[model samples]
Target: MHPLADTYGRRFPYLRLSVIPACNFRCTYCLPHGYRADPNAAGPLSLDEIARLLRGFTRLGMRKLRITGGEPSLRRDLTDILRTAASVPGVERLAMTTNGSLLTKRLDAWADAGLNAINVSVDTLDATAFAALTGHDRLSDILEGVDRAVERGLTVKLNAVLLRGVNDDQLPAWLDYLRTHRVGVRFIELMQTGDNLDYFRRHHVRAELLEQRLRDAGWTALPRAADAGPAREYLHPDYAGRVGIIAPYSKDFCAGCNRLRVTATGDLRLCLFGEFGIPLRALLQRDEQIDDLVRAIGGQIGRKEKGHFLHEGRTGITPHLASTGG
Candidate 1:
């Protein structure tokens, strides 16, 4: 099988596929006004289309597949999607990112369907702050779900967007929880999107500060895996859990990019903040179109920009995180 590589010698072995566009929470940094469906937008891809897409990706050396969404759990057929991903040849890891609202109720079924790892968005440990940030008062339930996932033997991680004067000062709280959780909690730097200029200016925090704090507390930097996502992880002898920092604005941030993204409607995005997407739904419609799908992906990989223009204050067409499953 031909590996998916770019002109700069970066090989992509990870695929982040969005299965749905609708999310339930209204996170302050993401969908602050809640999700508003676009009347003219096409619905999400069908199961058959998803299967073909997965097969095509697997044929091109994709070893890791992450099912993302505005909230992946909202998809009624998510279990089938997970099963299909697991059935695909060459897919070594099958994971998903969710808001964790439905994890407690549906995690076991998802695990049975082949989901082995999960990343849940938990902005804060404080219940009131969580409600204020996510427009949801389900922190307790979500935490319970996290515990359940750990008990069920699934590799679990938590994502929290770092916002100044918001959840930024909660590192101590996170450290306290990490002392026993045995999970990884990544603090993602708030990004500037097309519609969040004002909010970005108000709350964006550099992840470097957090990393330094971790270092001061005796956290040792861990070596990154070849197919891992863009998180710099740290480990501490006193803690069972790990700390991860995702700083998109850091120098040479895109140099190690090893993943590609596909939207819910089957559009390939070379970069999270890219100016446009290449439509791939037509090729995904039939099993016989796998070759064309593979070619389309392989062909586009060469034209991927060396890096995103985010540092230049350009967010491209990404209006919000939800639009691209962040």
Candidate 2:
């Protein structure tokens, strides 16, 4: 059995699966121009393969699943994948992270297919700035998509990547916008990944500084919500929802990391920044028995590193967050 340790020695229960490596937008910070796609990268996993892996994982005591991708909505059968995953014996909650451009078309269907919640990436509210950041001129589309998601009764959270000269000044405004719209906003610190490492180093804002700025804006850090991530969350006494900061670079939360990631091509990553992953595709292709699959998974978990070392730098890695299923 895989003895995954929690605060009280509890086995890990959450899994983040990246269903595809294809994205609709090329965010400047995520994957700038000139980045070449891998010629030998495997295609997306079949729905059956995804279902089989989830079944094995659920049997191993996983209950929460978050579907991510280059942009998970880019997948044609994403609803089917969500439905199959939800049908697993022990899987209880199914969530997804997307760029939100295509969510308008799939929101209701995804909800019907067992998607519980969604985290939408919206860096700024300005149309011109949005286009500059994402290499797409579709701010109106993204906004409409968010509206559609909320209208469908989907719990929506806005993910804002806070870069210094880029969108730092808009933090309060973003929070105000989400509050007026009754949506949650999360501020993510720029990590040293993709082509934005230099930009991140130059404009990276720390959580402490962010909190202080919020204080200056008359907000106070509140006790974090139970389901919240590493983001130190805050609330304006007058706002409907809350604002949070995810400072992965300034403050690492690897010890409390209860999640594992499965890349679209079927590589199971133990941690977000971990160097290696276990290949589930090969094992599935070999038609490994259920019991054997479980053992292999458990062994991989045993070898899971304590956490990722981002300071070590991406010396030879080439996969950006988008292609890696972030």
RMSD per model, one decimal: 0.6, 2.6
Report the number of the highest-lDDT candidate. 1
lDDT of 1 at 30: 88
After superposition, the stretches of candidate 1 with alpha carbons farther than 4 Å from their true spots are none
TM-score of each: 0.99, 0.90
lDDT of 2 by residue, 67-155 (tens): 99888887889989988988888887788999888776778888998887789999899899999988889889888988887877777
Candidate 1, 32-107: lDDT as tens digits: 9999999999999999999999999988999999999999999899998999889988999999999999988999
Which has the greatest TM-score?
1
lDDT measured at residue 127 in model 1 versus the true structure, 0 to 100: 99
Query: What lDDT, from 0 to 1, does candidate 1 have?
Result: 0.94
Clashing pairs in 2: none
lDDT of candidate model 2 versus the reference: 0.76
